[model samples]
Target: MRLKSVLAILLISISATSCSLYNKLVYRIDVPQGNYLQAEQVAQLQNGMTPEQVQYLLGTPMLTDPYSSYTWYYVYLQQKGYEDPEQYTLTVNFNQKGTVSDFNLDRPLPQQQDADIKPLELENNKSWWQSMKDFFSFS
Candidate 1:
């Protein structure tokens, strides 16, 4: 019957529309796993820092082997919705006397750029009229 067909069509449309609406309305939270270390924190690390000092600055290591008591590992991972996870690792090796001997970092620590600071200082020092003149200047 036409009524039955119309009812079926209405149900299908409602279900289809509901599926799309559900996707739009639902929020997916980002899942962050493991330790997060900052560049400044890593920069604080020195070759001769004691285990306690390192631990104080960087917190406890995420992974440490039972057999390798002198080796400490700091790991960080951040995962967000549909994006590649960010990861970094730092490894510290202590000598027999318990002083930090050497270390390795998966990524280089970010350095403060003088060029970036210089531009901001220059911009702040310039007057509004000077900025406008500079903007319109051919050179």
Candidate 2:
């Protein structure tokens, strides 16, 4: 019957559309692979701090110049599927005495107003089922 054929076609169309919709709505876990540093921690750095102190406050440097022991680099990168990757770099130069002589941070230090700001949402932390539910939620 034509009605049966039409119903079959409609069902097929609905299934196809639903499959595409689900694919689009499905959340892919963000891949984060690198050192991550907080603005507050970077701001705590001060001139004349010893290398040991710097290492204590902030973790080990990501990269150090092979030829020069005076320069140290702290690099951070975060990759998220839905958002732009976040990156930061800090460079520290030590004096002959092995104390920090100067340093530079790629991003500006957080101000008082920024202290209350929250970090970006980490989608990888959410379960796939939760993400699916959130994807379909009205709010």
Candidate 3:
């Protein structure tokens, strides 16, 4: 019995130190939060879209102004144990009549680096198919 107890103590001490087996035993997961808007979904957004329509298309905004109902915010965050964190923000403003006035899809947080931000837009307010054609067409 004493020999068994000593062996147990030795095994516990071995696992307490950093080792490949220890690392595998401890699992870390990638975390993704908030509205995960795809590029295709964002391109579908347009002026005069109703709140309900917007919500249906893009799921839901992460934040909204309490003082004013005209603005909505969609924020995305991704954290990975082995890589750098990523964040995205989209701000949508509506008219008093509750129609989408305009939106910014590439707006970055103040602290985030500006290297990867790109504006998401459609030429002439065209749909996805039309935009794809426009991209392929030289003239």
Candidate 4:
């Protein structure tokens, strides 16, 4: 009976100490301001507007499609707690003449494979066998 009482007292003290330590270590959640380009402003873009004018209005595009420089894309992504993260996408397709041909808000893009180069792993390590293999394997 005495052992049970001591164990309960120890557990209560440990739990209280843990709670205090947790309160000190954990940080409060931060709320992000989920505001970006206004739809009304983007809707104002017209077919004849030049790149400079479009930039002036929308600040800057997030990316220019490598396949077509004429196409400009803008994207913003923000994630916070229980609220579903907000993502905005805008794409402006231009004619060959460098004028806006059409534009859309929140258009889906096809997934593309990344072609970025991987860092060199065996940059300096060249064992004699590796060197010999590299020299003779070319043929």
lDDT of each: 0.83, 0.83, 0.84, 0.75
Query: Alpha carbon lDDT of residue 53, candidate 3?
Result: 98
Q: What are the per-residue Cα lDDT tens digits for candidate 3 across 1-139?
A: 9999999999988877758667767768998889886666787989999999999998888999899989999988888765677888888999989999999977544343557988888767899998888789987
Best by TM-score: 2
| Ordered list by TM-score, greatest first | 2, 1, 3, 4
Q: Weakest 10 consecutive residues, lDDT, candidate 3?
A: 105-114
- What candidate 4 gets wrong by more than 4 Å, as runs, is 1-35, 107-139
Q: How does candidate 4 score on lDDT?
A: 0.75
Which wins on TM-score, candidate 2 or candidate 4? Answer: 2
**Order of quality (lDDT):** 3, 2, 1, 4
In the range 89-108, model 4's lDDT, one tens digit per residue, is 88888888888888887744
Q: How many backbone clashes does candidate 4 have?
A: 0
Error of 1 at 92 (Å): 1.2
| Clashes found in each candidate (C-alpha, N, C closer than 3 A) | 0, 0, 0, 0
Off by over 4 Å in 3: 1-27, 107-139
lDDT of 2 by residue, 1-139 (tens): 9999999999999999999888768787777554567777887899999999999988889998899999999887766666777777889999999999999988863344766888867497997779889999997
TM-scores, one per candidate: 0.58, 0.59, 0.57, 0.51
Per-candidate RMSD, Å: 7.6, 13.9, 12.8, 13.4
